[model samples]
Target chain A: MTEEAPAPEPRPAPGLPPGPFAGPAPAAAPRQHLIVVRVRLPAHLRTLVQLEKETERGPGHGTASGPGHGTGSEVTLELDSPGTQSSLLDALETRYPVLIGTIRDPRTRVRRPFIRFFACEEDLSHEPPDSDLPAPVLAGTEPFVILGAMAGG
Target chain B: MSTIRVLVGTRKGAFILNADASRKSWEVNGPFFGGWEIYHVNASPVDPSRLYASQSNGWFGQLVQRSDDGGTTWQPVGNQFPYAGVPGTHQWYDGTPHPWEFARVWHLEPSLSDPDTVYAGVEDAALFRSSDAGTTWEEVSGLRRHDSGSSWQPGAGGMCLHTIVLDPVDPERIYTAISAAGVFRSDDAGTTWKPVNRGLSSESIPAPEAEVGHCVHRIAMHPSRPDVLFMQKHWDVMRTDDCGESWREVSGDLPSDFGFTIDVHAHEPETIYVVPIKSDSEHYPPDGRLRVYRSRTGGDEWEALSDGLPQRDCYVNVLRDAMAVDSLDPCGIYFGTTGGQVYASANAGDSWAPIVRDLPAVLSVEVQTLP
Candidate 1:
């Protein structure tokens, strides 16, 4: 028996969209009104976010003068409003769930042994959870840095 | 086709290795909680997809993670392990009274029937149970309040309740072993407890024949025969056929019996395994050979299996809770070493191979046989 010739490949109809050939459109960034809050994580804690990077700046910081832009060692967190230390942490944990208990206790909500907090070059680690952050930090001009204290000789 | 998942908890993180029934060509995945000490990882018996992991560090203290989708994603649940009421004191390492304290969990025993129910054995030698799927833990204070608790002292390790074995035959009965406090059994579903160290003796204690104060490293039991139990004590391999009523030395023909982990074959109730370290102080294998001694007749008679294992320059120690068995056709045996090797024996310990050569000093291993 004579072998049948292979059928010719079909092309998309003129009026129809490119169904299988079209790749998905780039995901539109979330449109919530975001507040930029800079954060600095310790070297050890850096391993937690080793695989993922929050390189995308939210709508709030379209300008290059965003908080932590000049500081080479800071990461920015997006929040709905100017937040306190705990609120900033809430935003951070929401973004990176793995860091839930690394910076604070899962139960007591106490700061971990070697984890310290700094804002405007002042130690704000022991401040009350609801206390308003420094004006520069609140204005997204200075990063709220998470410092891993010097441990072990 | 059968699938086997070997869950390994190490000093630095956790790893999961999967393979088919042929026991060849494995796939390894892990370091789930990287940079943290993963003391134990166990899956729910009723629902294999659900898992509980004990994650802790010196800096962060302790946290419990739950993964409903096997281990792809994990969520932090409640980490509060509060004593029921009026937390009392137990004897410290210095033989002085010390207040009770909450420490990291050493073992998590999921219920045999309910995926939401679990038991956590923690340091300071206390037992806590969670009926809400590990969301919150309530101490089964009867164990900490047992009369002998005050006399219980910490071993070189802290006074940690590291072994928890639930009786499949009786829902009300539970068994837990502590580092230096011996074994305690509760017949009232953790409402109350009593020490079960009747035939156990240790020269390290003042009263070697006393009710408590035996460093019980690990205990195992075949689900089919819940009344029969096997234990690896500080310096002896023990077996108790009548539950914990009495025990006898089964350390017979092994090179050394001062080992940390002991487990029973999943399919054969009479087959058992132990890695005999030189001694309690010297935690290496005898003669620098890593040999796993298996006793087909339950105990006493033993044979060393080292086909694919290191027979020289092997100085790694296997910690308690570091060995487990899978319920496959020939019965698969798996264990991890302090030197970071996870060995697997698919044919009842007749031969062996390492599923992973370098993990972070494995602390625990558990196997789940999937359909």
Candidate 2:
């Protein structure tokens, strides 16, 4: 999974935009956005999401809520060229309809109970539930992983 | 080589901090599974060889872990679940121990009367006792039946029974502090329960009794004097002499009174220790000047004991269950931080030394001194 370290990109502060803000959404696409999924998924739910191998469609088309909606059995991840927390999670959910209560807060963007977010080599636990993730991670060129934080002792 | 064994419990898994007596340093290995947020880790006193860990796992509910050879290898007491009626789940919650209602075991204390007798504090909020180590459990009917249920309210961490204080000498006389709940006593071995909170405050608008919402964060009684007590409360640090009949603030002398966890000397009943965790600020430990404060003559005076610590901005929150004192002669005081740091104090609370750093965020810290 090594690809020359993505050209020494500048790491932006978490929840903040990269470079100067031009407007609501940046025009430039993230140069290094790539999605990698790790799963210990249960068998029963596996059949509900119709499994698909690698199919690179544009943005949210691959998310849990995408146009292909109920067709895919795999969890999908998307980075809006350069990404935002809102877009990343939304993209994944758009494609995987069964992932309703898996990630974000069921009622809010806050992380769900027993669910935690880690990136930029730090636990982004203190960040506001709705804020954008660090820009470097949005680009997704680096490794982005989403897994369950199982309970019990 | 003779070594010092350290048991660390976490919301996701448990880790073992091991090292030689030389204290040259240590090693950490874990993420031990069984589901359940492990809030308490006790290295057995009778058998330094065995370790006990309790947590909210699933319908297999409460979890119990034992390390036979000083924490190197671990075995989960899975079958003991239905016996205690605790919940156990294999899935992750908030990426932490799955918190089950009918049973969420938060505290585990080994009985001094019978080494096999172990205690588990659950969420439906009952104290279940296991006589054959963690192999089997029974709800201590006396204390469990008398619980004041109507008053119990769910805290952000969930309303539960926390600190269980066992009399090292008299097992029959035990005390447990309930969160948002009050302090309870079982003098006749949980056969009967009564509020030990005299001076402790309650949420009662008309007349506050130790009924509920007085929420005790931790209850520390002098190891030698069961009558004398000290508590790091939900909002303050307090002390009492007549067995919780009344209390007084012993925390006005610090930066801020909002913190978790407190300790005392294994030898001297008068010597005490408390970590100054930031209550009103974003940072846990004020500016990283996280010195462990000690009060030799009660909580009358507090001297900063962070001589060898970092002088930079360090906001580390030390949990109520993360600080302790080993049974060494000069009395060694030890603690770890949310920032993944562990420090040691050889001379009680005088100065400090960093034993290890850059470990995972420390959830619980337990040390065993080998004879």
Candidate 3:
């Protein structure tokens, strides 16, 4: 039996979009760095997450971190490189699983109706989930804030 | 001597009212989980110190809190409640198909024997159980998957499975009530369910005498006589002596019979209580007088108990889960109102007093009798 020659590797034509059968593009440098982002949760969520941490740490470890301890606390989340809103939230929910359906819909991953996301003094509530956060938020200079909409009352 | 602990859930948080056997003076402790709506706070019959609170918010969703040291300290447990399989559609307010979704837990019924095994009645009308002390939850899907589920619709309130009464005599028997869907019984420990709504009629629905589709607000049963059940519907007070096999209207002397809560006296199986609202359109008491009607002969007769309750100019509504009774002698009856008053009747509804009158809108009140 004659062996058929392997099909030549498909290449995209110049000035044309890659076709369905085009070969995989050359590998880019691996972006496997970890980025630590800070998240500031509203009072309700801060109390919840804080209570969970205290429980895990056992009694007396964090008893002083009560609801009136402060306005909010920064939760450091380690996310993969090029972290976006979705990535940051995925990490946040993983770290604080109790927050799964609080900030966003568990099934749809859509932000809850009365929950807003903010960073760098701008409203990012309507931004796409995969959109890159502001420079300050990504650089760890400013925390990504989750606020309960004032209108919910 | 015994103590009565009234677990009060409200629009803003959970409060625990403690009083000695006299049931007079009280000490209120809470606002726990402040800013969150506490729908129900229940203690396990097997372990009075173990309690469960259903906390939720419009913005943050639901959280189940467990307290091992009674109501002294609480820790968040598993809040994940995934419906079993593909939750099919139920009728919406506009008579359109609405997919099933998990809103907030409306009630928590801890197991009569096992502290770890607890059942949750939730909005969007479904039942869930946690076998590991609130660490995990699994849907008891058979009830929601009933043959008549598709036709179920929400009442003025969202479609919520808000009442759960475990048959103390039969460990395998369970009873759950849903808004606008009547009552259901699970004989095989929640593995399967059947609508026990026969003899129930609702004028609002197309077929008044249909097997289901009745807005049953609350159901109560004296543990000693589980076969006899008392129900407060959207418009009538009903009773069933054959385990919901048949029901008869007992709303005879109640002023309006359009109330949200009905409960049984803890010691007297024949004594029952109901708060009659003016009408469906107007949810307050009749003639602006807040009254709790007590029927000593089970039904067809009731007497208004309004000594300590507001007699006029009161416009707050009592929710379905807001009334409960303690097992103490003379049976202390407790209920909370939307006007932020938690009223307690020390002498079985002969008179009443407010345990606390300035809390948030009261959603539910549960009582635990401790030795």
Off by over 4 Å in 2: A1-153, B1-3, B29-31, B34-37, B55-62, B79-100, B202-211, B280-283
Off by over 4 Å in 3: A1-30, A51-72
Q: How well is each residue in A1-153 modelled by candidate 3, as lDDT tens digits?
A: 011123322222112211232111123413557766777776678787763333343321222222123222557777776778999899888877878889998888999877777665566788899877666665565667777766321
Kindly list the per-residue Cα lDDT of model 3 for residues B98-168, writing each as its tens digit.
99988889999999999999999988999999999999999999999999999999887789999999999
TM-score of each: 0.82, 0.65, 0.90
How much is the lDDT of residue B304 in candidate 3? 84
Best by lDDT: 3
Best by DockQ: 3
lDDT score at residue A144, model 3, on the 0-100 scale: 71
TM value for model 3: 0.90
How close to the true structure is residue B5 of candidate 3, measured as C-alpha lDDT? 94
**Could you give the candidate ranking by DockQ, starting with the highest?**
3, 1, 2
Docking quality class, candidate 3: acceptable
- Fnat, model by model in order, equals 0.23, 0.00, 0.58
lDDT of 2 by residue, B208-315 (tens): 653445757777876788888888876677898877777888886877666778887889997888877766345376666777777887786777777877666877
